[model samples]
Target: MKVLLFFGLLAIALADNTRFEGEKVFRVKPVLDEHVTLIKDLAKSIEVDFWSPENAEQVTAGTDVDIRVPAIYLDLVYTMLQQSEMEHEVLIEDVQRAVDGQADTGPSPRAHSYTKYNTWSVIESWIDSIASSNANLVSKQSIGNTYEGRTMTILKLGKKSSSSKPAIFLDCGIHAREWISPAFCQWFVNEALTTYGSDAQMTSLLDQMDVFVLPVFNVDGYHYTHTNNRMWRKTRSRKSGSSCIGADPNRNFDAGWCTLGASSNPCSDTYCGATPESEIEVKNVANFIRKNKSVIKAYLTIHSYSQLLLFPYSYTYDLAATHNELMSIAEGASSALRSLYGTRYTSGPGATTIYPAAGGSDDWAYDLGVKYSFTFELRDTGRYGFLLPESQIKPTCEETMLAVKYIAAYVQKNLY
Candidate 1:
């Protein structure tokens, strides 16, 4: 009896250490009326990482939800979802494994692999290296300081395009838990440097347009995720008269405030702040966009797990004046992305395609008159949630590069 009890306790401890919750992303196609309510209920019961028309058609028609799951519980959830009668497809089942930064791979290199799986300190050094190497092409500016006093840096890639050339703004890792988000930012920079001369499209882009890249918007939250909890999302700034430690910066934008699909409870993941731009980081980015409104024609923000391409109207799912044009461009980008590896990506407006999320960066950019705003949810459809492995960094970014270039080319041709 004593031996059996000991084994039972050991088993319990092991299971608890593997206590991973699935970020189950579903490619859910809904039957318009029946599907809308179903998706909502599923979101209520299980967390929906992302939702948009790009990935799913409106509930009035067939729509698929791209679901993501954390590493530990992926198998369990995937098997369960597979057995369910719902018409769901699992696009990618790659798992993001969590390992020590100093895992015994070999002797440490001379310098940190700052562009990959890096902390804020490493990232700062990496940026400094790039700037020092390419004095003419790269210039850095401190937009402002985050709550923790870390500088919010922005890289102005390429000369500001002609007043009529149309500019695109790219920001990533707004949510700290999505490490892969920042990875793409660094990958973008590497690609730009490596292929600038040989890649015709890239070369043309460099000559014609200005790309503003904010590698990580929520620096404090990102740092916290690395040192403390792995799943920490949102900014680290505390609100007055409340004990909640952070606010969902994405949901704290000024566009629609927090009307639908946002939580007021500070503890909730989707908590919107007391007011729009409540977080200093958001204000800094917003201010930059506002200051550059005439030239900043497009805004592209990246997040992870869900393979989605979304446009404006996150506050509400209704179509925009340029909805037809934006939707058409998104479709083109999706097709380009698919060409690389038959990777399937959905494109559509925010409200009709996914849950109503107010205060999204894309929507705010659109409201600020940056009409070509978009949000790309990158990498695995779900098996490994936020722990996307370092191995996938190359292919994921490469495939995404096609879509970005395609969009840039399209914008160039149609720039008015």
Candidate 2:
């Protein structure tokens, strides 16, 4: 028993040591043409990790670029930025401190709460309980399994009907470190169940359309974040002949596979994988979406840190077929979201609004005939980034709820 206990304690110690002690996240704004090349050169010289925009390749003039640098390179990075005359600021002075400060220190909990960042186990249990408690409005389906054999459960929320109803598909946490993404999904479930009859918009939404919520899209990576690394951001899949263990599930779709804004290197954060649908998690979600393409009208995939509501064609500069209508709806949704907290969100086509990210699920969904497809990048511009505090969870989710409801209501009305 003592031997077993010692090994268990050693495991916990190793996990806790994964925290970023001396790492700092810097936000730099490039003004001159040489500044971009300077940032690229910095990445090539050292292990500079791009936090926002996901890659150094997306760093451009007029946009704030956030990158986390190792302790040893902090002085060198600051000197380089000064010499290059690039404007920069430290967003997070200590990354480990920010990571540690994300969770609530109030008290121990027996059950999951919407305001807290719950672990994969807590979330799984909450799903079962919530679906059981709200039997008529919520039911779960095991769509498929992750690469690590963890079950991928999607919760279907709607009023039971004799016949099938048009549905909207919403998924969150496709990239694992964005804890707020999954939190919003769980909060959405809570709001839907708690305000089913009282909230007029929600009631009408359930009455007209079924909403499928995949609360945690990247199960394996999410679990890894809680157990091993707080910043793990890909599906935990091991491929033969590669030292790396995961692929960017967001970039694993068939739409413009391995194109711009994605990496062919297996070790990259935005690694597109061996081929389209290379990750089992992506393949599973794709298969489910394909299976229910007839009834699924809208696809909303939630992400974080950048305040943007984007539509399809992220793979290319080409505008989506339904560009005008999608842009109008996105602007409306952004307006609704901003009304709550005065939090502004830019609305436009993903490629033009941001950078060209190929193989994104929204692009693929739009190509698959899901006309009303969108991707939501939620909360604070760059102050918090991925390490958003737990206190902001309620406000963020509450405001996001408005935008999601607005979209759902619109989709229901325009279901013709």
Candidate 3:
């Protein structure tokens, strides 16, 4: 009886983790209309997961589309690619191998490390401890609870002041699978606290402006990725009649909600939710921002797997009112980031720089008077995609810190 119970528990544990055994990630360069059509057709036919560009509809000529094909459809996909003669290469030969190899070897330390991918519980504990330790520099407040009942806390980093300070709202891990996004947020917090008095630029930014850091925005979805599916991108909310779980928190915002580059189908990775602010997580952040819109001069949201620093108007092709200045600031920030490791990052409006991803938090924030809104797609373009290795975390975060500080400084200088 005891042996049976032990084996039963082991089986349950193994069953919870969704393994990507022979799945392959391919970077297909769609140069012609035919190539784009072919790619779209393949998505309609099989369960092709778009790693970059987010979905099939966003695939266009001259852009390299990275997709993950299931093991079962590998032969079919290969045949189609060969017949079409589309330029393509395998980014990840086996996703399971990449997942296994992404993390550092040996057991992870019990304590959270900035250089490693920490789970939600670990991050939560770290948030509490860090805020407590750095009482003068950081104070945490629970904005709200996620759909899964996880407390969504934002750490306000600045010296305590008698009068309210102008602020920048920075959030990471809007998309659950982007572990590096949240990692960078943690790094930013650590860097801000540890280098407060010593780092002149950081000290000035913190002293003058309060920066609200939501380390992991989609807390429930992030927790799901660590415990169950490493590739889960949406929230874990369930509808009554539908079996599909979660909506893309990034696409659930009110700005051009459910328009281009988003899907109405709940099962889609980029599902825009039933309505704007449908997902409780999105609502939580949106509500918090709305309440503090007066003092929140800038908004920055972090995402990963595509090295691009994008500004507003993702919902439309129209130029932002402050386009020229935004572009100049982005260019400077990109230059600052590149100085560290020579990791190139393209800078421009979100729609033109990448695909038009409507309902993005940055676009929503921009329309709500946060003129300095920006979204960061960090790390190697597509080599590793969502499964970036632990080895690159330190370098990625270190360089990203420069760009973020550059933006904060710009916002600080321009505040009237």
Candidate 4:
């Protein structure tokens, strides 16, 4: 009876995983109004997954849209694309194949390695161990719990000081499936601790300013992506009377809450929560920032597969109050990042650079008087999209480190 029960549990676990066997990711370039309309129509008619623009509504003329279409809809999508004569190419011929190839092929190790995409369980253990390993440079505090009861802790990195020191809050993995985001956060923490005394600039920055790193912000959704669906991108909170599980935590912030570039539908990929700060994860971070508003000088949020550095005013086209300074700083940081491996990064405001994404953490942070708020879209232009290989993790994180250090040094110098 016990053997039968064990096999039954194993079957249930295997059944819960969502697989993508023959799904294809396509990059559609719509240069005309009709082409844009056709893309939107395809989304409305079929179960198309928008990969880049976040949703079908954000598709516009002169912008490249990346979407994943299931095997059943392949013939229809091909017909529509050929009929419209829209410029399109298949980025991934087989999504499952790409997903399988993203990770290294080896027995999973118990220890955490910065170059590999670590699971939530592995990351949680690493957080506790890393914080305790270096008491002087690192200390952690749980801000709150995620919707699925995962503890959200922020690792504070800096030299011990007598009085309260100014801080810069950096968070990663807010979108869950962007595995590289959390990887970069882990790399940043490791780099800071490992090169403290040897690297002059790092030593100076840590001596003066505290850098708070949230390795994985959307803990629940991140865990779901690993165990159930590899493409899951939102929280895992269940709402009454609605089958949709989670909201876009990035869009659940209070700034310009759901005004533009966000969907009111609970089923959307960019669903703004029922109300601002609805997701416990967002509220937990928001409350912490509000409590330390005076000392937090800059906010940096990491994301993937765009290779862009964006600043405030994603909710609207209007330029930020400190637009000139922000642009200059972003340009310099981009240059520093490019110096490492010639990885070019376009730096500009979020709305103008990419698309109008309302209620983003960067925009919210800037509005809350954290003048130096910025969002990073790291690695490839779209060749791999979110399925960036584990092999590129080292170079990606190394180049990004230069850009982040550039921003930190500037913030430290300008602090009043």
TM-score of each: 0.78, 0.94, 0.95, 0.95
Candidate 4 local lDDT, 1-416, one digit each (tens): 12222222322111233788998999999999988888876676667779889998888999999998877678777877777788999999999998999987553747689989999999999999999999999999999999889999999999999898999999999999999999999999999999999999999999999999999999999998888899999999889989778999989998899988999899888999999999999999999999999999999999987999999899999999999999999999999999999999999999989999898999999999999999999988888899999999999999999999999999999998
Which segments of candidate 3 are over 4 A away from where they belong?
1-17
Please estimate how well model 4 matches the true structure, expressed as its whole-model Cα lDDT: 0.91
Candidates 2 and 3, the one with greater lDDT: 3
TM-score for model 1?
0.78
Tell me the tens digit of each residue's lDDT in model 2 across 180-284: 999999999999989999989999999889999999999999999988988889999998999778999989999999989999989788999999998999989
Model 1, 317-404: lDDT tens digits are: 6788899999999999999999998889989987766557887888888888887888998877655556666667667888998998
lDDT of each: 0.72, 0.89, 0.90, 0.91
Clashes of each: 32, 0, 0, 0
Least accurate 10 contiguous residues by lDDT in model 4: 5-14
TM-score-wise, the better of 2 and 4 is 4
User: Model 4: residues >4 Å from true position, as ranges?
Assistant: 1-17, 105-109
Ten-residue stretch with the least lDDT total in model 1: 10-19
**Better by lDDT, candidate 4 or 3:** 4
Clashes of 1: 32
lDDT of 3 by residue, 1-416 (tens): 12222222322111233889999999989898988888887776557788988999999999999998778777777777777788899999999999988887544746799889998988999999999999998999998898889999999999999999999999999999999999999999999999999999999998999999999999989998888899999999998888888999989999999998999999899999999999999999999999999999999999997899999889899999999999999999999999999999999999988989889999999999999999999998888989999999999999999999999999999999
Positional deviation of residue 9's Cα in model 4 after best superposition, in angstroms: 38
